[model samples]
Target: MAGTPIANSSTKCLPEGMPSIMGAIYPIEIMQDAKRLVVLAEFLSQTRRVHIGEKMPPADDTEPSYNGYSVARWDGDTLVIETSRVRPDVLFFNVPHSINMKITERLRRSSPTLLENKVMIEDPDYLSRPYSFTFQYKKTDYKIGEFVCENNQTKVDAEGKASLQLQPDTK
Candidate 1:
């Protein structure tokens, strides 16, 4: 459960939005197998995409509408995920990434009580080089509860219009 911090403590910027769902916690029962892991990640990724007002256009249309495409794999006890083809809809620390951006993540279960996640972001459109980050989570015996972001709504005024507040200076 060791790596770089996901966010800069000094800055209060929210990259995607105020209600941005970066990670989740699930019962050990749900993550018992690779198939389950893939299913859970896909489900969560889809949920996040839809939350950001991104849409899946008709297959016939050449233009892209979806924010990002993700694929997951397992490396020993670690789950490696690669995401690309982002639609420049959500901002990273209020800075947007282009459609060519790609992100890689590695999730490892360090112990029965802890899970470690490391994320690498590569976007030539916005960043000078690939930046990596890590996030740690503690396990709990509590059952998984219903988690929803849309239910709790909050608005912020940015550039004279109401918008979701994004975490600032996320690296």
Candidate 2:
């Protein structure tokens, strides 16, 4: 019980961290300092801050949140991040991760202007073995927009049909 607010069976309302984990599939903004790193995604305005060279806190100190408890270390030029304690949430392509799940990400500089993140996901409760993939990001000067998820941003109309605003220009 990591105090993660999951959607109840009766109410399919979006949870507190609805798209935080879901946003993992898209582009991210990486902000790093001497002791920590921040992974930010414009969509849903989700962010995960990883403490560098730090051990996982005591169990009581961690909650099964969207991004889970993440720690990172440098392996030569690459940064290795290990994350656990994620709630049973949709982590990738409609796949849910159990609390026992762990994700290992190896991020390295592919080129002077390109970065790559190779992720490995493991969850015995759902996945057969480990799933691995890589996502790349090109260094850019474009600024991130202010994107936030609003309550009932998506809704079912009177005819009992779900309506989703998919256009990027609309809020």
Q: How well does each candidate superpose onto the true structure, as a TM-score?
A: 0.56, 0.75
- Scanning candidate 1 in windows of ten residues, the lowest lDDT window is 9-18
Write candidate 2's Cα lDDT for 40-73 as tens digits: 7765566787889998787578888867888899
- For candidate 1, the TM-score is 0.56
Residue 167, candidate 2: alpha-carbon lDDT: 43
Question: Residue 99 deviation, candidate 2, in Å?
Answer: 0.2
Report each candidate's C-alpha RMSD, comma-separated, in the order given: 10.9, 7.9
RMSD of 2: 7.9
- List per-prediction Cα lDDT, in the order shown: 0.49, 0.68
C-alpha lDDT of candidate 2 relative to the true structure: 0.68
